[model samples]
Target: MNPLTAIRMEALLSGRSDQLGPDVAERLSNHPLDSIDTEFPHYARSVDSPDGIERPTERHPVFFGCYDWHSSVHSHWALIRQLRLFDEHPARSDIVDRIDDRFTAENIAREVEHFEDNETFEKPYGWAWFLHLVSELCLWEDDRAAAWRSILKPLEETIVTLIKSEFLPQKRPFRVGTHQNSAFALHCILDYARTLSNERLESAVTDTATAFYAEDRNYPVEYEPLGWDFLSPSLTEADLMRRVYSRNEFTMWIEQFLPDVTTAPYDTILEPVHTNPNRDEGVALHLVGLNLSKAWCLAGLASTLKDHQYVEAFERSAKQHMECGLDRAFTDEYAGSHWLSSFVLYLLTRNEGGIAPE
Candidate 1:
């Protein structure tokens, strides 16, 4: 499914499956796409980097500050992924109209101009990703294809340099940290490679994925000989009646430690065996509901196209989220982020085309 269609589905569903309908989709197609500013209100009052704004400047919508490459990577992946899904989905016309009005280069330039008046340079990654988004939007409209082709190369080259200097060699026992979050980088690399059709870039991405997988596999051994154990959470007695965690881990945990939380196996918490000695003692909960929901959606999309490898990847990805549980990563709400929601809808609804016969 196209990105806009996916986003439209997400908007329709919000928190309930019943809300999704053909009429709703039709109505949204006519609605103009709102920029990040409308969705995230804090942007208007958001501050820039310490050195970015002059004393007289007022805060703009901050996107929480564009200085961090990590955020940029996520933004890039989300935009590209959504766009790809949008272009390919059956509901293309609807999304095309909405995004055409909102995400155009001129619109992006206007936003940037507003920020520029404050003399705040978005982080390098932010600039790179936003440019890419604009270029893709141009491609969608077929209005500035030549310009995009000319500009994309330099932006990508800059990103490549950033990766080599700041992202290479990979980190050990990849936990959430500043540079350790190279998954977003991998996503960006893949998007750029797909865009530019560079085999060399593709190879780089594969190699990085392999290394990251190896780390996940050998997480325990990589840490101290004692192991890469994670900490677990302590539940309050008052909260016992509430759903403790999803069914996935609940079953696994209860099998070894008693009591199934529910009927369907829900997402669970995971820890590297070697280092996880402390996991049970820590209070970090998993963000399973949010994570698995997206994973399922991604897997569903891949499965619809009969891409076995991608399907596997989506399933594995979903499993990771289930293992992570809701509290640990996606506790903001059952809904999580809008991008994730839209991605899932795209995954779930994209022309089922056909599921290979089992």
Candidate 2:
């Protein structure tokens, strides 16, 4: 097993946004920094893989880079967020210009058409990211963003209907750390729902979450990161529950679902994961994401249960997980760098009311 990167704890725990600003800017600034732009890694079922596929750029007009479709979508979310939060930063004007040019109605219409006849296009993962992109646009103070949001609303309604009808009622959670992970998707969409006051969307997510996870108890907790994992199954569940339940209910729930977050074993979820991308280049990069995402989840969880005995433990563990990967993730192998910054900004610039937009 590869040892953790061993970065200083302070780097992750610090309050200064400027510390990671340059890294965030760089990740979104370049022109499709990885080969996915060239190789076009569109994952498709055999039934859907027809004889001749158009190139990635031709297929995905609005989001055709950053390694994969979902990564490209969230990169857009991150760039919009960075521009809004760091308004006076030097890169702001250029970012504004870049977005203005790309977010045109024609490009957005092409993006909408890309979903034609594809039933499982993006599913909840990519669906959630698209909503996240819209969520940022909702809060952004620019006419260009307003125009883009107008063009994007039809697609948004399409996802909201799909989730309510198909995705949520499956009544099964994808208990993994990757794209299919239900908790991660629900977490992002739920936040988007609350921010936009979409009561229907919010109800669909909370209902599914309660049905899927309300009774989960004594999660294996130890058997996570199964080789190619990227999110903490049990921890992500706990994080989402915080949003669904009141303080007292969530505290009671966490005590049983993960009884060791603060004591004895102190929970294996807290330990920094180690990875050697050289061994399995693609799978190993997930460890970096697992660490950053786990950190944000921990931070969000701790905020809700402030008076619990394990609050400090959650906060400390969050920093440790972040220290393990936040800085290193930026310039690490392309497998990780092309997309990790979106999660980085989402966590670091997180507002007080949990994951809801600032």
Candidate 3:
């Protein structure tokens, strides 16, 4: 059996989400650098289930090139470092090493041998996500400077070449419904450029960021946590709301900056928003809001907006929304139940005299 597939198959059988989170964390601590060099081989072969039969498969003879879970793979490295739970179970490094062996340059180049240059929507598939994974890996582990250089140095040039050759002059907007992917790509470039101090990549990222933010106002676009691929463009506003993470982020971005107000005619309003219907949604919203609102407000108060009025306004906004944004997020079954309200319950339990903004 192919090595990466074999390992993944084993992991799947090992009680994934519930049981393996800690196991994975533990293994990472002991083997931080053990399997750093392994990579999964690209495959084109196929096998029928249980019965011997022919089946279609990826272009590569081993693992599908397009199936590269680069982000998830690299994320393993970061997770090991951050949680420190991997110290007890160091044997798990073998799994990580198996894949890194196949994730090398020669492997990737072979995988992209016939990649098309003119396809307008290159899917971006998993490349940017992997780059972010690499960044997280380097940041958390430290002393992985060589790994960072090995992965990012060549990758940046490849991405920049694509941007200059294919993306720069396209008068038409990108494939509709790909705002998040565009944002992720721009972020990868910007982040790596900032990390490595690469001026060329920085300039390219600036242009891409400007273009992406410009497109924000036209249609409903967001980075939903669970959806796969790009979602369909024609989803109604209500359905879109059901999938969007929070109205809070929308409000935050819209309040200060009108990035792409012209390109997105529908989003011209100052506070376009959405809410998830799951009971857990409200809790998640409050968690995100409190963390970010306090941080942003504190920074603003400390640096630029030191006035009493600005401070009061900021505090009032945070306090008001700390509990109000949940109305649409929570289900009717739990709507009136205060105990179920994450923000309200948190405020009640903490019971600290609140800041008066200034």
Candidate 4:
């Protein structure tokens, strides 16, 4: 049954700033800086690289940390977001210094070279986070923001073009709720597109959303959240649909998509996912993300639908998910630590369709 039916407002986060307590700010401030330059313990797609490809740092100038390309980009997004939200976040000045060092014209140019070598390097996932970084920068409109925007233009343009022409056309929805998940990536892309008022990018994402998900009914939620998943294929799709359809239309569509969600008390899917944290492997730590991701999805859906049926249960479920994953996010496991806080920030901020900036 849909646990979102009874979600409440009290359980919803008051704001993203609440998650950045002194300790949390310190933790976030240091996490990415510690590894933004370290190269190993990373994953890269060599298929797109030369036979003797360089290490992660050598290949990706700016985004070489946090286990993989997308992680690094999202980490950067998290860093900037944290700094923007809190003026006195102990590490604010240092973050600006670090950003200046990494987001230089020469460095971004090298990153563009890498992208040229591998046109579909990160496909839509990394592309989305890159856009997320750009979107965050767009919120600034400072001289530094303008410089960074211009410097990253080539790479940004390529990604936007691919989403409209190449990626969207060839794409079939990936419902796995992982890096390959189309809904999650498209969700990010759509958010970025809307913020910039890029009709081309916005139209492509909206059309793709309609084509891929509009016709779906009786979605198979029972098989959801595969063991290694950090995303909820069902919920992420529902969240995306919320943006694509109007309130009346989305309400109608969501009820069909998750009929079980209409059930009272909404307890069937409320339990936090269990994982064997003793294992430090990346696969084992995804449960933390699963919980946080669900929290944001529930919160996002409730805000979008604005229906009484969900205000209570959705908020409670989101709070529970955040509680389950909060401590686990700051872990010793690089597999989890490097990435989990970013997800936490995303949920905590609840930056729905660009409202945070305004």
Candidate 5:
């Protein structure tokens, strides 16, 4: 019947469905639905002047929950993804209603105004996720998706314009393992660009990635997973470059860049970092995300280099990291719960080849 429903049915009939059964889908979907509208415990990153403080909902009508702005945006993305993959989910009506309440044209315009006012507010991370949300809406064939896409067009245009004028022109790429990491943002932006058929933005991302990382060598893999880190800078760069280069070219580049991926010091990148589930510090929860992100990146590398010498290593590490990451993804801790589901959803989808490619 429905496209998503049809896909799920086909998978079931063919016995091709993986671990993302209806129960796990419901669990993952429920987290974002519960937090997307919750007001308290917000982490505002606004640059408000004295006497200008406002509630998160007051500042961001559409994306005011999920601890922070980017988390809220990607939480929305995760919800839409769940709805897309599981057509008969128990929370289907709730998902539709929440998205309907949030995707109003007026609300989106306010979001645009906020973005214009705070140009560098979310920078590469949140901006990339916002574009990704729009991209997801663009990909769905549902009527509601079309309406939401239309409402989001202005904000999408604003971000696309900003990237063309401001972000792409930057000479240096942030190689950190956190939100500021340029490769992660570029990878997401490139996906959005390709999804929307925005060749100019695609070219800009390709050129910028090349300029920033094309000649990279000896990535010092052992020095990664810095405290409070969620992404692997070297693997993220490799993931982005795989999108930029053809199979042959990327093979050559990765061989040089991570020459010792199968050896000591470098192989350490494969081990998932330990995350304390009962930790009090919010930032300590980043290790959970690090495991998930590493799984995602490693899986991508393994898929791309299926015939390469290090493909087995990549595959083994991806599986180990994914298992470790999933163990911590459903934590009761607010620090992990508010945002970790999105990473979980992403990793699961990537494993199933549901996400779009470059």
Candidate 6:
């Protein structure tokens, strides 16, 4: 039998679905390894002048694969996360080699140059995931991780500078359920800030999150899971607020934001989304990610609202979304396979234990 198949069988027998054991690590690692270096069929999302259009590999030497820039960044994070969680896995050395090859200082310098030229490029989403990747490397104790972190420091600083200068100053938050969602970006930035003990960035994110969403009440959960949405605007906002507010403060804030938390529209938000199999691959597959992202947000909310009346319902919906998401996360179609594993890994590890504040 295939080794991975055997591992999955063992996990099934042992009832280890929720555990981040070697079996799960092995399964999740395959997605990144499969697409991280596959450069074709790429979505550059780049701006070019008449001088020339450059290939994605040239434009983004370090993060030019896995369909698009953000997906590639998070896929790298997923690989590093797998390595951190299961050091003894058979693919550890291969994972290390791949990271080592891609994380060269020169490559990162080129990536930095691209971002510098295109100031608004991948503003929050891609930038958020890049910092997340850096956070993972920063926390890992391995010498290799330290080396990569040092190499990545320049780009990391560039992104932080951009976030503070460009994004935080906006008077209003983008409350959409897509990549532009301000709440989701703040969620990621806050976690990265706290992980590295960067007080300046932390304060900036706290202030911005509070200003953008602290006054929110009666969130329109009914309008969620918008056509191609992978992130829930309401849930992501609540999750980010959980990190910013104290437990007591968050308790009150959530009660107001998601009032009547267990009924109609809220219940509708909890229900896992299903995509019509016949729909276009790019559009429909987002629902798969929507399920995983919802699971992540709901799980974070449940963790913070442990004593709330709706906690049990949140937990139940989170599980349902997780199962529904995991069922389709490992697809062969490039549309889903290129990026969904990162969402799977993120949800499985609860954003690598960065859900709540220290």
Candidate 5, residues 166-208: lDDT per residue as tens digits?
Answer: 7889989998999899999898899888888889888989999
Q: Work out candidate 2's RMSD over C-alphas.
A: 3.8
Candidate 2 lDDT, 1-358, residue by residue in tens: 1122332455535433554555445554443333224334454334446768676677776677766788888877877777666656556666666566666667777777766556578887998888888888887777877887887776677777777766888858899878888988898889888888888878888998999999998887777766667788888888889989988999899888885755546477678787664574665778888888888888878878988888888888888788776645665556666777677776666662325432
lDDT of 6 at 354: 44
Better of 2 and 5 by TM-score: 5
Per-candidate Cα lDDT values, in order, are 0.34, 0.72, 0.35, 0.75, 0.81, 0.82
How much is 340 displaced in model 5, in angstroms?
0.4
Candidate 1 per-residue lDDT, tens place, 1-358, comes to 2223333323332222234444333322221122222333222345656666532112322232222322322343333334443444334554445334443444344444454453224333354344345334433435433444343444435545555444545563233312223443354345445555567755665565555442222122122112211111111100110112233433233233312212212212212111122343222212222243333333333334343333354345434433333223212222223222322332243232111111
Per-residue C-alpha lDDT of model 6 across residues 1-358, encoded as one tens digit per residue: 1222333422322222345556667778887898999999987554667578888899989899998899999999989877766767767888889989889989999999988898998989999998888888877788888888999999999999999999999999998878899988888899899998989889999999999998899888988777788888888898889899998999999888985867865679889987665665775888899988888788778877887897888878887787677777787789999998888777666644543547
Model 6 CA deviation exceeding 4 Å by range: 1-18, 46-51, 278-280, 355-357
Superposed by TM-score, candidate 5 places the C-alpha of residue 69 at a distance from the truth, in angstroms, of 0.7
* TM-score between candidate 4 and the true structure: 0.89
* Clash tally, candidates in order: 36, 1, 25, 11, 0, 0
What is residue 69's positional error in candidate 3, in angstroms? 5.5
lDDT for 215 (candidate 6): 88
User: How far out, in Å, is residue 325 in model 6?
Assistant: 0.8
- Distance from true position, residue 352, model 1, in Å? 9.9
lDDT score of residue 29 within candidate 4: 57
lDDT: worst 10-residue window of model 2: 1-10
